[model samples]
Target: MSTDAAELTARLIRCPSVTPEEGGALILLSDVLTAGGFECHRVDRNGVPNLFARWGAKGAARTFGFNGHTDVVPPGDLGSWTHPPFSGFVADGMIWGRGATDMKSGVAAFTAAVLDFVAATPPDGAIILTITGDEEGPGRDGTRAILDWMDQNGERMDVCIVGEPTNPEVFGEMIKIGRRGSMSLNFVAHGVQGHVAYPHRARNPLHALVRLLDQLTGAPLDQGSEHFDPSGLQITTIDCGNPASNVIPETARAVVNIRFNDLHSPDSLFHDIRAKADLVQAETGVSIEITSNISGESFLTAPGPFVDMVAEVVAEQTNRRPVLSTSGGTSDARFIKNHCPVVEFGLVGRFMHQVDERVPVEEIHALKRVYGGMLEKFFS
Candidate 1:
């Protein structure tokens, strides 16, 4: 019993399931999984589409889970593509389309692997698939919705794997054990507006904001942690919206994004920034207001049995020992980490969310074999 992963990937690519749109991708997967003897459920919440499919009993003693998103970033500049973004065109031994490497291929591979695995040797345990359609968007209603539904419905998974593109350059080269915490801080400094020539009449809010930003970026947050690089603070934007050189603006606004490691939490970082803003305000008399939103906190699935098993399978199949890294941006694994130990592995991501996104035909098939091997090792 074998599944053609490339063919399945092509079919998925043709679905046009961009962020927040089902585009028939979930419907197609439901039909296939149901045919393969799995129970399927549509866990739609707040108008976002999610699918939960399981094989075996509701709560088996040992259950393996796979998480992935079918939604893709919008394809930019259609004319720039050799083939239509949704064409799923295969040429020169590659499947060319949007979501090819970003991860329709990965979903296809695991789906194929699990379907074939059960048909051939039915594992003693259970398998669960949580596929979401809102990863590329605001993500308020995608996998989170499915997990909420799962908790309410008494569904559980022992360990989970997120099928996100973790490899940067080649198949089996990298696996994400964790991701850095992410947050954005928005600052607004208010002062009296006046003519630039009257230095005493107007307090320049821009000056105070610049000083605050300078303080924030003056030092490294920390030396690189054990599994992660040093925390990064990047000032994404600074604006006063003032056009007149002679007039000082009343308010200046800026935003800084931080990718932090386990050394810091959102509270600690916010407190530190608050202290800095307080000092700047005292020195300059400009009222400073700071607000922050946290995307996720840093997490690591420490080296253990499940992690070793996944690494061993990839090494044996691809002859490449994957580096267990936590160097990438956030993913849905951040949400899954709260439920169970979660890690990310999938196709090389060099071309994801780019023009002419694609994946090699052979790589898709190889990924299926790797996923199938993981299933065998897990249940053995």
Candidate 2:
């Protein structure tokens, strides 16, 4: 009998695995995988849960891998749902829950497919599944920790697929070949405080901050790049605590976030922005302090045999030619990319993270067949 992916999804949805909290999700998966003849390891670190399971040799010549996360974002104001957020309610032929679409369904489908694949026609190569509980959290230790452990244990994948929701409108409309880089810069402008009547006594930092912000947002970062849209920059927040209209605040704060393409790197973007800040400070005589954090760098799995094969499989299954896109925010694929060639494809993501998030039962089954086809093509 084929593994029931929809039922597995419902069972997983019943697990309350919110970020950094296992909620029995990984354990449930471990039980199923271990029983299916795969080696399972709990690579939990720093209070975050992770699972690594493999079938076949440790260092096989040809290894196909899959990555996904079970942790769901918190269900905000639970009263708005048609069914309880964690009820795993199956009605109208759709599974309703917080992670039903964002990814519990994808995980269930792939897990079912892998189990059936190995049970029927064990591949000549190995298969690895990396599931993390920290994807929706800070993500410092989820997949990264598993990868670190794999390095020490001498385990690696030749190519990996991250089952993030890739289709925006339909089940196989898109595949992620690359993702744009993301970073944020925080700026604090310092000036002397003084009375409003004495304009010359204080260097107004807010003036310099406004100018710096205007300078940064005045022009486009770039027109566009191959396989990516132009870089985007947004001033997310600005603050000055002074309540009195007559008082000149001593400090002004602003935060800017940039989502960039391959044409730029964090260092390059920071240098250019800092120069603008320096120039503004020199002209305005206000000290500006800038600090930055690079979340993930842009990367691409160039169109080749692996990409072509995945696309062909998707087109074959859904009868829709998928577009190779790099427009989404980011995923664990960013981490996996550092280890091996990685790409992302999964269910339609129209309802992910929204109230009453769900996936069609048929789509879940279809995703299994697609993943099964991937296994067949890879091992043949």
Candidate 3:
């Protein structure tokens, strides 16, 4: 790995910025960006610190943005890690840490590559880097605030590349042109408490919830779109919350999530899914209530010249033809797509968000080269 990449990755890993907390991660990035001649903005929105940095001459109509987050999911059961989760240990030609590949590494790569690129030659066009700290949590802040700030600042981008780790098996093997929108729902069916055998005396919410699941998951949401696949709805959980063996619980609940393609909107999809639950209400005495835990709505960027430029530079640097795809979970890219055409391409993500997260040191250098080349080619 390049020393700059290794040093910066180690710095980020040491910050301990587990979702919603800065933990020094944002400071590390801000310092790097400031040194690179970019004007940096530190905005605290909804309690999360988001950074937006830009560098280039005025009137450069062509602006490129690199977006990603500094936060990572919690390192569950710390005992499961081979090395300390925040140690940033290096062995076997890889770096091991929480968010090492999921992707503090990608953040480091883009930042360092931009620093180097700008130092050698002042950017021919504007380059903006948007970093957020609310990706793995409630996500009520972060990117949404950054985009709003950009709009108020009169910043428009030609294209934005989100450095989420997109590769599965080989570096540069996949580029996510879009993401499946995700929505999570918790449904509760209310009924009267009763004996197991008393059917008419008390409504059985459990039965209503079970039948509702049947109708909801019975078929595919749609046949898939040109840049996306058929919408999908998966039941993540179900609970009667009844510990008693002989008594029918007064309430039953189920939590479900859907990764939808462009075929549906979160509002429409939620309305449709809720209608199925309401059908049970029409026939039964039970009451139904549904609530949402939103991740993001699905979004896509139609492949065009800017996307082509990223693909060509990636193949040229890594010699791996990137697969143009939108087949992944939701990301901050989902939010950025509304402002500009955004695509995601980065290091191999085999071990991201997993115990003992690690990235091959070789891949780090390759990603840096790819990012540097993309910046040079796009603005030249």
Ranked by lDDT, top first: 2, 1, 3
TM-score attained by model 3:
0.94
Distance from true location, Cα of 98 in model 1, Å: 0.7
- Name model 2 segments beyond 4 Å from true: none
> How much is the lDDT of residue 13 in candidate 2?
94
Itemize residue pairs with steric clashes in candidate 2: none
Alpha-carbon deviation at 309 in model 3, angstroms:
1.0
Q: Estimate each model's TM-score.
A: 0.99, 0.99, 0.94
Model 3: per-residue Cα lDDT over 264-353, one tens digit each: 888888898778878888888788899987787777677788889989999899787888999878888878888889989888889998
Mind giving the per-residue lDDT tens digits that candidate 1 earns over 1-380?
Answer: 57788999999999999888999899999998999999999999888899999999988989999999899999989999999999999999999999999889999989999999999999899999999999998888998999999999999999998988889888999999999999999999998899989979999999999999999999999998888999999999999999998999999999999999999999999999999999999999999999999988999999999899999999999999999999989999999998999878899999999999999999998888988888899999
Error of 2 at 192 (Å): 1.2
**How far off is residue 126 in model 1, in Å?**
0.6
Show the colliding residue pairs in model 1.
none
Q: Give the distance in Å from residue 342's predicted Cα in candidate 2 to where it truly belongs.
A: 0.4
